[model samples]
Target: MYKRALPPAHYSLKIQSFSLLSKSNVDKYDSGVFEVGGYKWSLSLYPNGDKDNNGSGFVSFYLSIEETDKLPHGWEVDVNYKLFVYDKIRDVYLTIQDADGAVRSFHDLKTQWGFVDA
Candidate 1:
């Protein structure tokens, strides 16, 4: 697992003001652009969970690849990813991921991947 310096065992993501994340407007929030393995990506938070996937009451986080149009046909990237949530009360990040650490392939047909429930 990847680790950040905030603590010895967990990664950190700081959101300045969480008041902007409302149940009715979660679709508007984004973590903006970031880079990983020379590829562009972004994170999205669904505070109310993804009801369409029967994930209500749990938070939903998604990692999405950006600028897929730049890829050539049949291009694919294999990725191994993990998702985490800071547990303020416990002061630890609640990590969620596949135990097998399977590599997922992203290509022209699929530009994004992540857990619908986390």
Candidate 2:
């Protein structure tokens, strides 16, 4: 079991306008693509949670692979990711992640993974 004392990599996302990300306004919002371990990835935000998953009255976030068309069929990637939300009142980042160092698989069929209860 690989226990990450801290994330091997991290990305900070800033949302300038909260209202613009609401589910009623937009289905989802995607952060610009980034590279981790040489794989293209992005952060997807569902401000109103994922409707299909009963993610309402809460924020939903996901990590997804990009440029899948460039990858070979059946190719998959395993990754460990953490999501953070900044608390203005607390002046700290609230972090949520896999406690046991679980690896999430991203493949052709399922290219994204995340917490809907966030």
Candidate 3:
């Protein structure tokens, strides 16, 4: 984990009136398509935590590849990614990444990667 003044370079998801999600019983919410590294992607947010994945009391966030059907067979993407949460009061971001700083491989078999408790 790290703290910095800059926001995530690849993408960011900001939810206004976030409290309404829990009030409305939205278990999961997916953001619209966004492009990165020539591939389409989206953010999956579990505002009230994903109970199925063992995220009962914490927020679960994930990055999902989109439009994978368009990619070639056996396609894969190597990504060194980081997730961030902005602290409005502090004016900084709390960033989280793999401890080993490894490049994660995304392929047909696995299209999502993220923190179960974010």
Q: What is the lDDT of residue 14 in candidate 3?
A: 88
TM-score of each: 0.77, 0.82, 0.83
Index of the highest-TM-score prediction: 3
Model 3 lDDT per residue over 1-118, tens place: 5444544457778877667776777899999999977899998888878899999988888888899999999999877788888866678988877788777789999999987887
lDDT of each: 0.70, 0.83, 0.83
- lDDT comparing candidate 3 with the true structure: 0.83
Across residues 23-80, which tens digit of lDDT does each residue of candidate 1 receive? 3565536788876666788877777777777778767777778888776777887777
Candidate with maximal lDDT: 3
Lowest lDDT 10-mer window, candidate 3? 1-10
List residue ranges in candidate 1 displaced over 4 A. Answer: 1-12, 17-24
Clashes of each: 0, 0, 0
- C-alpha displacement of 12 in model 2, angstroms? 1.9
Candidate 2 lDDT for residue 34: 93
Candidate 2 per-residue lDDT, tens place, 30-105, comes to: 8989987778989988888888899987888889899999988789887877887886656898887877758988
